[model samples]
Target: MTPPVIETRALAIGHGRQPLGRDIAFSLAAGEVLCLLGPNGSGKTTFFRTLLGLLPVLAGEVRVCGEAVAGWSRAAFARQVGYVPQAHAGVFPFTVAEVVLMGRLARIGRFSAPSRQDRDIAADCLDMLGILPLHDRVYTAISGGERQLVLIARALAQQPALLVMDEPTASLDFGNQIRVLDHIGRLRGQGMAVLMSTHQPEHALRVADRIALFNAGQVIADGPPAAMITPARLASLYGVSESAVSASLSPLLSPERNVLP
Candidate 1:
């Protein structure tokens, strides 16, 4: 049997001396897209960092590609797991192509220069994301949407089996949101296991194969989007009445029975 790309068993994640979320048992297999849906400060970021090995797991285990994450070195782990962070201001003056090429550094020794194939892969990633024209632009000079695309391209250049994205469409306009979601869907079709966090229930409906509903630091529900995102479940997760949820969701999700004239 092919092992999952990432698996957490009885996992507890948070800062040292403080556990934020517990019993977060889940497995993400290749060609899967699992969306973590939660409100702000609900420990979604904490869980994400822990899975990326940036923070310590307070208990339980996280295995990536059949081996314990704790046993893998930074470079070894990065080779198989890539991360796409929320778009942020860049302090450095690195060009877009340069930033994408940085992903290959996991395989390239720190002291070594990027090889021809490394450059090719970077270019390919940019092309794949339809952002090859931004190759020479200063990373900080791009708009938020473009910056997010660049970050996705950078993670793709890593050629990882599993990708973790944090709010990939957070600040984008409506069209950009669809574009980002489309890219995510494309990646899933290409057999990459994706674990991403988002606040938008609609985004989960559009892209997630599975939804993990988070509330008060733990996963309240985990299942296919169709099964997990009922009006009652959403209302419970967000502490609202089911009628309010149905009303808000009806326009984009179904008939307008919940809404009134």
Candidate 2:
């Protein structure tokens, strides 16, 4: 069998002298979208940091693209994994295209400017995300939804095998949330492995090929969205009354042809 693009074996994710959650064991195959669902402070962010190699692994191991992450250089890792943070403070006045082109810095090498090919790739990424029209606009002047799209395009410009997004639609309106999730679903269809953390189970059920529910520093459930996101499971995971959980999911459980995977 082909090895997964990302694998964590008994992985312990944490920050300075503090372990976030339990040891995690999971693998993400190419073309799969794995959604990490948990409430705030449930170690979701810590887990993402660990996966991106931003946080130290207190125990276990994390392997990316069939090699230990620690064994690979930072540049090599960046080339393979594209990460989009939850929020970005845009202090500079760079154009959207310029921000997106920064994704190619790892490939461009230090002290070297981007070449024609790099610009072409950046443009292609913007086009792929349907944001090419905004390439010339100032990033800080765009709407929040547009900024999110720019960030996603930037990640895509890296041409990574895996895309990791913390909260792709944290504070967006309903329409923007659907737009972002739809774009991510398309990325998975294009053979990119995607892992996103979300507070909404309905979002996961709609787009994720697999779902991993995190609680108290460990994954309590990991499986297909249909199997793992039932009312009973959600109630247990959220520590809520079972009836309340069922009531809240009525809309999701209703018949809908466009239901999430």
Candidate 3:
């Protein structure tokens, strides 16, 4: 049997000597979309950072392709995992194409310039994200929605087997948010495993195969969207009243309305 694309066993995460989270056990298979939903300060980003080897794992392990992540070299890790951080303003004015092409660095030689093939891949990624027309635009000049799409395109340019996105739709207009979710569905259909974090349970319902709810610095629940996103569970996760969660989500959770309001 094939091993999971990414897995964590008794994983713990933290900053310096302070532990932010622990017992993050999970596995993601190819073509699956696993979404992490949680309140702010619940260690979602810290878990991501630890998985990407940016911070030290306070305990336990992160594995990719059934091997410990610490055993993989940085280049090997980059080739296997593409990361899409929340979109932010760029200080430099690199063209969108140039920004996407940066993802190709892991595959290129140390001293080589981007070849025609690299350019083609970057263009394809841009086109895939429906922002091909923005290829030559200055990254710093695009709207936030456009910039988010550009960042996704950049991660896709890596052509990695797994994509880890942190709040891919945060701060976007409603239309752009839907667009990002639609593209995520498409990417999963094309057989890339996706692990993403989101503040919105509605977004998980739209695209995720499995949902993980984080609270108190750990995943409190993990299962199908329908099973994991109930009013009671969401109330506990976000410190809201169950009736409030039910009322606010009634329109969203109704069988007739699959689309977010």
Please name the candidate that would achieve the greatest TM-score relative to the true structure.
Answer: 3
Q: Cα RMSD (Å) between model 3 and the true structure? A: 1.6
lDDT digits (tens) for residues 83-178 of candidate 3: 988867899999999999999999995688999999999999888777999988999999988988888988898989999999989868887788
Give a tens-digit lDDT track for model 2, residues 1-261: 778999999888777878776569999999999999887788888888988889888989999878889777888998999998887759899999999999998889879999999999999988876789998899999987788888988998898999999988886778768877888888888999999998888888888999998988888889998898888888888888889988878777877634544
Model 2 — TM-score against the truth? 0.93
Tell me which of candidates 1 and 2 scores higher on lDDT: 1
- TM for every model, in the order presented, reads 0.94, 0.93, 0.95
**Superposed model 1: Cα runs more than 4 Å off:** 255-261
**Candidate 1 on 54-141: residue-level lDDT in tens?**
9988999999988898878899998999999887778899999999999999989789999999999999989877789999999999
| Candidate number with the higher lDDT (2 or 3) | 3
Candidate 1: pairs in clash:
none
Give lDDT: candidate 3, residue 186.
90
Report lDDT (CA) for all predictions.
Answer: 0.89, 0.87, 0.89
